[model samples]
Target: MSEPKSLEGVFHLVHMIKRHMHEQIEQLDLNISPMHMRVLKIINKQQTCTAVDIAQLLNRDKAQVTRLLNELIKQTLIEKVPNPEDKRSQRLLVTSEGMEVLAHLTTIDGNMNNKMMKGISREELKEFERITGLMTENLARAD
Candidate 1:
């Protein structure tokens, strides 16, 4: 049988990784969805993140991002503080609890990546990253 095309292989790999991550997260029983975790991570990473910023980053609608933010707030994982520059907008901040959860999620990602790259050498991984970076640049140029 012929090997799968690069795009097809990449798509399949992404699907499997997402599925595995979802499974691992489900085992935590934290009552948080993957998207919620994503928002939390983004909030944790950004110094002054707004709901609109998250919407743009995730390529999701504002309403959807707002819903996710609301859920995170309800869970006490994140809080909103007044944006000094914009009175109308608030900046999202990950709470201490959110940091703990984020750390766990990071661990999960690290473990998954380690497993995925088990047999790959450092050079091979570096080259893979280089190729993917070029691919990302190519796609960006198409936009």
Candidate 2:
């Protein structure tokens, strides 16, 4: 039997689009990578969270999360504070600089999403999200 064309095309398109978005961010002057920006976004939204929070949220390892936080701190885009309840734990927070970065990135993100949905109606967008959510659940269960 032949492979399903629609599935293969969707996979390739997702990969290509993600790669292009990364490339676009790479052209920016920021010292952070796309991964770091993702972390910053979570930190920004949460106000303060531990490295473990990021690790769990991103489905990444704690060591990797630590390294990313270290780099973000060095770049002055995020600040680390001692967790009030645990001296050994640290919480991450986005700096004013980080917010500025997020603001610009948010604009780009909105524009990209808008472009992707240009011809799709609101109902179509909702259906797309529902289908994607189901797909995500299926994949998670497969693991």
Candidate 3:
């Protein structure tokens, strides 16, 4: 493929992957967007998460992160507890319910990965990852 076609193919693959994931999430009837799921995963991974931390990590605005956090709180998937070291800020924690959702999401992700890699060899998958990593770094440097 030509350079332009290769870029277009990458974009198309990303769109398809996101659309498929969204459809899967919708089937869960969890009433959460992919972005919300991402926030939950980040909170689960981080030791002490906060709105600011999520915003920075997601490269999104504070307002957007706040909305996501509020939705997650309302869903009872996450909670805010007082920060022991910082009286001014509260830390975010994924609730037990959120952990369950994360487990489901993990299964969905594994299935998707397996489907995507069905015909690809391990060596080819490793090369794809390396190439994608380089492409991501290239884009970052463009900023």
Candidate 4:
């Protein structure tokens, strides 16, 4: 296999990681798809998250975020409570069941992180994260 050293390599790595993560998510009996599970995580992190907030965080369109939120609601993984600050918007939160799933996903995430970073040092990882962040900002600005 060719060593990945460019932006294409970074994207390839992301795709491979996503594939394995999706497989791991599929092994759970929670009935939520990997996308829905990810939405749950966003809601869990931001108790007052709006669909717009989630859309921005995910770099997805508002319509797509709404679709994912709808699925999460149908599966009882997340709930949309009335936004006290804005009558037109609803705040998203993860349900008790979703929290449980998050806990399980946390373990899965840790395992994946460990395996993916086996030989990489902490400093290298930090530098990688910094570069990725810069790249993300560049893309965001281009959009």
lDDT of 4 at 34: 70
Tell me model 4's lDDT, rounded to 2 decimals: 0.84
lDDT of 2 by residue, 20-124 (tens): 667667666666677887898899888668898899999999889889999989888989888997899988888898888898789768866877788999999
Q: How many clashes does each candidate structure show, in the order listed?
A: 0, 0, 0, 0
Report the lDDT of model 2 for residue 49.
86
Number of the top candidate by lDDT?
3
Per-residue C-alpha lDDT of model 4 across residues 92-136, encoded as one tens digit per residue: 888888888999899878988998999999999999999889977
Candidate 3 local lDDT, 6-99, one digit each (tens): 8999999999888888988888877888898899999999999888899999999999888899999999999999999789989999999999
lDDT (tens digit, per residue) of candidate 1 on 28-138: 766787788888888888888999999999989988888899989999999999999899999999999898899889988898999899999999999999988998889
Q: TM-score-based ranking, best first? A: 3, 1, 4, 2
lDDT of 3: 0.91
Clashes of 4: 0
The better-scoring model by TM-score among 1 and 3 is 3
Query: After TM-score superposition, what is the CA distance of residue 21 in candidate 2 from its true location, in Å?
Result: 2.0
| Clash pairs detected, candidate 2 | none
How much is the lDDT of residue 106 in candidate 3? 95
Off by over 4 Å in 3: none
